[model samples]
Target: MAETEESTGPPATLIDPIEMSKLDTKFREEIHSMPNGEELSACFACSTCTAACPIANIWKYKPHQLIRMILLGMRDEVLSSDEIWLCLTCFQCQERCPQKVRVTDIFFDCKNLAAEEGKVPPNIVGLGKELLEKGQLYTVTADWEREDMGLEPDVPGLSVDGLRNILKETRTSKLVDGDK
Candidate 1:
């Protein structure tokens, strides 16, 4: 028989095994310490949370996978991933979790951490800016439109100064000022 190279999948030499020792094992502990993150360690990789998420189909990492990554100490990967920022805070995941894990809240903590590291998405920053500047996410109705609808043009007892002051005193001010 002629000499031939037989394929047995890819050669083992081409694959690099992950070195577990290098992972930041303390990451799970840090998450658990955060408020509403206390239940993170209770997740058993159940897909219930993912199944309940309305946006999971579009997410690169499903809710269950994100929790698994956090448990595995994949801090940088989890923190920098767009999946963390994509969560809608709808609480469906949390509501469906078999372990009662606060999946949505944990994502909130991850977002806060990401924001602290200046990894926030531009749209979210813009929303914060809008809220700080206008005390509302959407524009108020104009007088003509309100009159046409037989409604008051101005909201009753609505105020923006209080909201602006609150934002100014919190980290949101820094976000609005482009500090992060």
Candidate 2:
């Protein structure tokens, strides 16, 4: 009997055969127009980005795989993926990339593209709404708790209205208002 070696590539689920219809030949160029985007094509699939990623362990598609997908012009799949949204943006991947691929920044571009398509999770949208309205995340201290701690009910010298005003003219405003 002849002996055969096991498949050395990534698991079958991580890589599917390419379909011409799913590719966007221009998607790579679209990303290239964004900051730090030109480096994307330099990726050599060394998996260094994945190895340096702090949260890669939990990702169905690690940073390197995602970069490869981007290089392959898997636009729809890349934009709609949860992995793009889940990146911690800690720069670990980018810092360790031997090719200087700017992995983290490319992911940021991918996320912005996803948001433009209204693909953001509802909770993220809610958070943006809360910030736009209140100029902060959820309340940092309860009124009653502040009073109990010998502090004023509200944080002194802190006003969110000014911040809110500036944000009103930003893209966040359009996004929160359900505009593309």
Per-residue lDDT value at 122 in model 1? 84
TM-score of 2: 0.81
lDDT of each: 0.85, 0.85
Cα lDDT of model 2 by residue, 132-155, tens digit: 988999766756777778997667
**Which run of 10 residues does model 1 get worst, by summed lDDT?**
1-10
Clashing pairs in 2: none
List the RMSD of every prediction in angstroms: 5.7, 7.1
- The sequence of per-residue lDDT tens digits that candidate 1 reaches over residues 128-174 is 88888887788677668789888887887888888879888898878
The CA lDDT at 72 in model 1 is 90
**Could you tell me the lDDT of residue 78 within candidate 2?**
90
